[model samples]
Target: MERIAIIGCGGSGKSTIAKQLGLTLDLPVTHLDAVYYDENWKPLPQEEFAAQQEKLVAGERWLIEGNYASTLPIRLAAADTVIFLDLPAATCLWGILQRRWRYRGGQHHKDGVFDRITWNFVRYIIGYRKQMRPKVTALTAQHAPHARLLTFTSRRQANAFLSEVTTSA
Candidate 1:
């Protein structure tokens, strides 16, 4: 509950759940998108990004959200809890569309970056379950053996867990 890693596909509501959990648990929140991308949508170097993540995880408490699977092992090793949002691809596609419309011509509310919804992004979301999920699952099992792992197959389940956590808190 203290150190949490919220990993999922682009439109899988990782930022949303991280924010809610951060509020409920009184922990600081870090969006990996914000950490990796600048306001102009420029990316930080991979080494720099990993270095930044290293510093964040060294803290005693935080809720870090993103699906940068390459560096997942770092956070997984440090987190006390890991939440994997395994929502359907269609739902994730719809989420991206909704997010584009909601934040039209402006910075995204969650990450404060103006991201484009390109066809490649859509394809990535669609292929995530088949491509990325297995790797993420394996990484979690291998790297975060002692961490409490929670996988939600749908948004309803994720919200329900949030509600239960909030109420208990």
Candidate 2:
């Protein structure tokens, strides 16, 4: 599908899925982290961030990944597909650890992704399903009711979905 939106808690593999979907669909991928944060980890101004997303979503084909709930409607309104990585908190925490080790606790400038970890982030991940899922679900319904929604509760399901996509592509 074109104009895809990927959302999830930190370390839930939004970026990973976005990359795979981009490759399979031959769509350009935009990591919202790249758009929202700078090399120094400074965030872009809120208005500018929203504007950037507006422009990105206006494109004919794109795969944007992030969970900026406040700005979610922009992408949601435009996406033809939305993929939610609804993995358990434990899995997500483990993902953070693995990514941290892989990056050696630093930033990847090319991807504009930071691999830093903190207690707050852990807490957020732990609380995401309870706290954020409803909001995300509501937003998708409100803004992209026509879009195909795909929610994977486990990595296996996600992998199988990817395999199917790859085969079709």
Candidate 3:
């Protein structure tokens, strides 16, 4: 509840959930995309990115949303809870489309962050369950076994969980 790591494919609502949970729990939120890329979409170097994540997780309470699987262990090891948005591929694709429409001008609601739809992003969403799930599952098991793991298979389910958290908070 205090320290959370949210992971899933693009458009899985990871940032949205992180914002909601951060508000409900009175914790700071970090949208990894905001930090990982500059306004012009230049990436932060890998070493610096990893170091920055290390500093972030050292805080007393935080909710970080991202799927940088390569740097996942840093957050996972520090999290008290891990929320995995495991919605179906079709649902994710639809979400991405809706997001693109919502932010049609390219700039995201997040400051200095831009949204771009690429073929690779679409293919990643389509192949996520088959390709990324196993890796994420294993990483969670290995790095955050003590953390509470919440996996939501649909948007409704994720919303319900958020409602529960809000009530409890």
TM-score of every candidate relative to the true structure: 0.95, 0.97, 0.95
**Residue 61 CA error for candidate 2 (Å)?**
0.3
Question: Candidate 1, residues 63-139: lDDT per residue as tens digits?
Answer: 99988888999999999999999999998888777777777745564653345788888889999999999999999
Give lDDT for model 3: 0.88
Worst 10 residues of 2 by lDDT: 105-114
Cα RMSD to native, each candidate?
A: 1.4, 1.0, 1.4
* Per-residue C-alpha lDDT of model 2 across residues 7-49, encoded as one tens digit per residue: 9989888878888888888999999888887878899999999
**Model 2 misses residue 145 by how many Å?**
0.4
Candidate 3, clashing residue pairs? none
Which candidate would rank higher by TM-score, 2 or 3? 2
Model 2 superposed RMSD (Cα): 1.0
> Considering every candidate listed, which one attains the maximal TM-score?
2
Q: Whole-model Cα lDDT per candidate? A: 0.89, 0.90, 0.88
Which stretches of model 2 miss by more than 4 angstroms?
none
Q: Write the per-residue lDDT of candidate 3 for residues 1-169, one digit (tens) a residue.
A: 8899999988888877887888889998888888788778789999999999999999999989999999999999999999999989999888888877777747564532346889998899999999999999999999999999999999999999999989888
